[model samples]
Target: MWSVPVLPFKQLISSALFCALSGLAQAGSDLRADDSRLKSLETTDAGRDWEAVGRLDRLGEGFCTGALIAPDLVLTAAHCLYDRDTLEQIDATSIEFLAGWRNGRASAYRSVKRAVLHPSYVYDGTLSATRVRNDIALLQLQRPIRNTTVTPFETDVRPRKGARVGVVSYAQDRSEAPSLQEVCTVMARQDGVLVMSCDVDFGSSGAPVFSFEGERPRIVSVVSAKARVEGNPVSLGASLADELALLEAQLTGTHVGSQLPHGVSRVQVGEPRRRDMGAKFISN
Candidate 1:
């Protein structure tokens, strides 16, 4: 996570509720809003399913959903590649990507060939994600995935006001489950960002938000942040297409870092810890 965490948007809502509902028990449970759902591999491609996206380090071991973005690129949250407390980079060698994981099957397990976090991700402490700022990462697999079940590489076109979109990811809190569901709508686009009614919780960070641009699904943004008032997930456009073109020319986007406050890193954190408790964020 940057000076900010990729996930403080919902934390604010949780915090607000933690303070206000400390006394009401179940009566106060719904005081705050929540993320709708993240899409899942199984739901999108029934022929194939996610095994598990695993990474290990001196810090510990964890998992997340890994979706194919390109022949060699996998998209996930930037925080998954860095340390939350230290703001230090994680050893890529210690990282592993597991796909098609389920019922004791490797489905797909590959080492991270390379990882590229969003350059503009802000580390500042501000967490207004109605239109998210920081929440994206790209990982290249050692070997290209070749299977029909695998989702194809795609990114969103400029969103329309009521375009249909949803999320899919392996969320936390469900130790032995990966339920991918569709329940989000593109609410608006402000400042070149896409807003959605999609709900997100821990483990939902970096999940791809899809919109039907034409015949195929186009990814518009990634799950970046959330809100207490709107009860929807804020997604930021993934600048990979334009960013990669820029990086090739020796450049990066200035939106995130340029707008961030001091004392923050360029990386943004979005995925949640294994222990967090919420309505299994972003179905899928």
Candidate 2:
């Protein structure tokens, strides 16, 4: 029951197409000169009705995207897991995370309790541009989100070279319905990782990646990749607090920010996501 379509981001844009390919993959001059504190993107409509904690499944039938960051996690990509060498498990008992989701209804459907896939995913099928190098994944909810736009996971600001990113998914089809556009910018940043101009297609893959701590919008990056810069397609990514400092050193303490690594159990988030986040929210 998540409905909120207003449309009009250049009519869902398909013209900017990654800013008409003004460039591509170029950052390594030794790298590491981009620090932070440049700010200048303040978004309105309360961060655009801000509420995207992702999930919706289907793929072979339809849909695929994700968000949510701790308070029950939810940060998708690792090829959305599942096809793990055919271990298959997509519709894990009705998964959902539609915070502010459109055309589908869920303004807050929170369920999902699994979906890991990032120990170096190998789906033996084809989505492996080199395991997409830990294309990132996580969706652990059983319930813990206090909400306020469910935004966590910052990876502590890194990606630079223009900085001023944006992107809040629910893409569906570039127009005619399903609102939410999110003005973008960043443009480039390789090593620290970034290539924005925010605007994606087809469910807008694991979309997240906002920038505005001065205004209070978190999430550092996601949206795996969707090339065509020269031919006109966009979206490609990495940099969620700079890969959460290597996933907080392999999720030590589980918060990727610290506090879980004691007995290492406490994972259980909800009970539907299907990759396993159930059993261990504090059981050891």
Candidate 3:
């Protein structure tokens, strides 16, 4: 029951025309920012409990949202470990995780020693549901963080379509501190990718999607991109249950050493992805 906001006549006309041309199906309206629920953690009470969700700093160049899954393991989008302009893999040593970051301080900080992506993940300049499904990466920390305040999250199964979910992300405008969308919905599940009705932006890539099922929260997906499908602003994510297991198995073997199968050096020329659909495929 969300209505489009009143806009100037020209803007409204242009919007209508754009929707028509895009062939977007008119479904539910996009999510609205209440500020009360999705407000900045820097000035909110919810910030006190979200210590495990941290910022993945890529050598001061940029950042992406990440969360700790183990004492020495951090989870994020595979694309975040590469440079967008050059498409080159950023050295794992150059990345750091700032847990519970707020006002230029962090409860725990650990540098990355290695990173592993899904073996099937290849950046072939194509954007598809399968690509997003395998867009996960695991960062091995140089040192383990054994703090009570920064407990790692547990992984869980993917939620069904129309299920209620939540997201914690550090976006472009709110990069200083993370924000929590306590209420978002899974719009659809195409192939292995999830299209969610959550609000995300540039730095929101790799943000953790959570499900409040039991006593503790469990991670279900990793944010990959934001898009406008049939006029509805939706966020894309990859289910983590299978992806995490594969990455863990890769890390357990020597595949992560000299014979890294998911190394970022792999790329190929192919159909360029569509960027005009509000898809911000950013490293952040």
Candidate 4:
């Protein structure tokens, strides 16, 4: 088990918008015994099938995980576009998507042309259900990746509690290539957030959480934050169905604020108190 400090219930309550507090209290034991270990996709053959899942590199800064949803559209976490120190939005041109990067090589490389964040998303540096729910963003690539091996993934509705899911992510320790956690349990789904028994860490933000219920896996959520529930580590993600549609609409100029320059509009919600709920944004 991951060694993480326990978060006080009061602090968790303060941070949560509509989380199932009762379910979270008992989440530690909800993980299934069959959950698979993280397997490194380091070799070309091993990572070939996941070419669409790539590293979103912020020029001089660090990187976050992202996945291609269309020929030119990349989905990722909204916070990945903000400077952690200054909390300022980063330039789209400075961002690059390194697809299927492994062992000093990549299958395809593309620069970001434009980016859009959920209008309601705020970068106040707090861990809240509100933030997690609105954490998704879409990046328009300067050039579409048309490689045969780099097919984009499709999005799907969120999974139910106890449903088996998987995650493909790059983290601080596993930065060169992505790792696949083929099996994890959705411990709880409250309001619009999913509390899952998936392992994630810095640089895993925006990593795609996939559901394999159908013939092919489809994206169900994006890694938002890593937290401890009942002294056990868990990853948090937003239910994608509605939020992803909103993001797509924003990208297609259908949403009200879609015409904004840089395609980003910021709304200020009352900032929640900054408390360490044993929660950390999974972005490097």
Indicate which candidate wins on lDDT. 4
Give each model a TM-score.
0.63, 0.28, 0.78, 0.82
Tens digits of per-residue lDDT, candidate 2, 1-284, equal: 22221211223223332232233323221221342322211233433445554545543344456765656666766555453345465654355666555444444667776555556445443322233334666666677677665455443354455666566665545211233444455655443335555656655666676666546566666776565433444455654543444453454425444556554333322111111121111100
Of 1 and 2, the candidate ahead on TM-score is 1
* Full-model lDDT for every candidate: 0.47, 0.48, 0.71, 0.76
lDDT of 3: 0.71
Looking at model 2, report the run of 10 residues with the lowest lDDT sum.
275-284
The window of 10 residues in a row where model 3 has the poorest summed lDDT is 1-10
RMSD of 1: 10.8
The alpha-carbon deviation from the true structure for residue 130 of candidate 3, after best TM-score superposition, in angstroms, is: 1.6
Model 3 residue pairs with clashes: 24-230, 25-230
lDDT by residue (tens digit), candidate 3, 165-281 = 889988777778899888888766545566677878878889999888858878888898775555556677885755676687677674422443564221111121222333223
Best-first order by lDDT: 4, 3, 2, 1
Is 3 or 4 the stronger prediction by lDDT?
4
Measured over all alpha carbons after superposition, the RMSD of each candidate to the real structure, in angstroms, is 10.8, 19.6, 9.7, 7.9
Give Cα distance to truth, residue 181, candidate 2, Å.
25
Candidate 2 TM-score versus the reference = 0.28
Clashes of 1: 28
